[model samples]
Target: MMPKFTHIENDRAKMVDISGKGEVVREATAAGKIFLRPETLKAIREGTVMKGNVLATARVAATLAVKNTASIIPMCHPIPISSISVDFTDCEGYIEAVVVVKMTGRTGVEMEALTGVSVALLTVWDMVKSAEKDAAGQYPVTAITDIRVVEKKKGK
Candidate 1:
């Protein structure tokens, strides 16, 4: 049987209690991809997106998102993040955002890492919307996908 949700009690939402848990070194990594036109990828690589540096802006957004995950997520614990790394890679017709978050706290940083990648990809999409839009001002081939946690570790 599936366990009850950790953030629910008496049909009301609540934060998980981690007061009794010991602090440990925790790390998590997440990745996501955004598909776009080949021309758009070239533009991003050449720094000609008309919106300034897309990768740098996305990195900043991802770092901020990782640090603020607890505030944005309803049931997440406010962990002290020790390190965060955000990077982007250009695939054949897509861009991949990878995020890693490390912390020494009672709980893991999986949510933070995932949030980092999500916001990073969203930032990229925002910066390249004009380039990816079709003649009808609609997005045809542009999309965000394959968002998942790639790694998680906990130890002393």
Candidate 2:
């Protein structure tokens, strides 16, 4: 059978009901890459991105986003997240950020993991926009890719 609340029969957007569902420990992991120009990467490595630590700021932002995921996404339950961890690694021409969110609730925390990765990537873009601006002065594009739930263990 199709999942409930995934569609609107006529114009009503129904939220998923979790009143009878058992609370299970769920975890999700999402990852994204920020491809930057050589110079942009150098600036980040040398600690000169908009006068602050880009990676550190992004990590914090990702954690905050995890906590507020329910508020930003309509119809998602406000799960009590137990932990959120954000990490990044330098990958030649790109920076890869991964966010892991953990929670015990009736609903999954996939959105939280996704939101964390997205916000972290955005934060990196914002901090390096000035350095990576195109000839037309437009902000450099940051793409969010490879977002997925790496693992989830259902409670018995």
Candidate 3:
């Protein structure tokens, strides 16, 4: 049998009830990469993206995005977030953003983590788009890819 949709009832969308569920320590990590041109990458590395520090700006955006995930995603509960961390890794022609979120609540924080990574990567794109855009005014080399939750853990 197919699984039932958690947010649908009586053919309408609705929020899940988690009031009865016991609060537990929840953690989740997500990651994604954004491909950029070599010149753009060098500019990012040299802290000369013009939009200011790419990683630092993205980190702040990720943190804020994680905290506001519930507000943005319908059906998500407004749970208290205990901690959040954003990290980055540079590859051959791309940059990876990893976001981790922790909470002691009735529900997990997987969505929040994923949202953080996505927003962070998008922030990177915005920061470097000017440098990567071609004469056609398009971002041919700028792309956000492989966004996924890498880890999740509950209460100890």
TM-score of each: 0.93, 0.87, 0.92
Each prediction's whole-model lDDT (CA) = 0.94, 0.85, 0.93
Q: Lowest lDDT 10-mer window, candidate 2?
A: 139-148
Question: Who wins the lDDT comparison?
Answer: 1
Q: Give the distance in Å from residue 66's predicted Cα in candidate 2 to where it truly belongs.
A: 0.6
Sequence-dependent TM-score of model 3: 0.92
Q: Tally clashing residue pairs in candidate 3.
A: 0
TM-score preference between candidates 2 and 3, better one = 3
lDDT of 2 by residue, 4-114 (tens): 797766987778999999888888888888888888888888998765999999999999999998899988789899999899999978999889888888888888998
Q: Look at candidate 1 and tell me the lDDT of residue 80.
A: 94
Backbone collision tally, model 1: 0
* Residue 134 lDDT, candidate 1, scale 0-100: 94
Ranking by lDDT: 1, 3, 2
Q: In lDDT terms, how accurate is model 2?
A: 0.85
lDDT of 3 by residue, 1-156 (tens): 999778844777889999899989999999999999999989989998898999999999999999999899998888899999999999999999999999998999999999999999999988888899899999888889999989999998
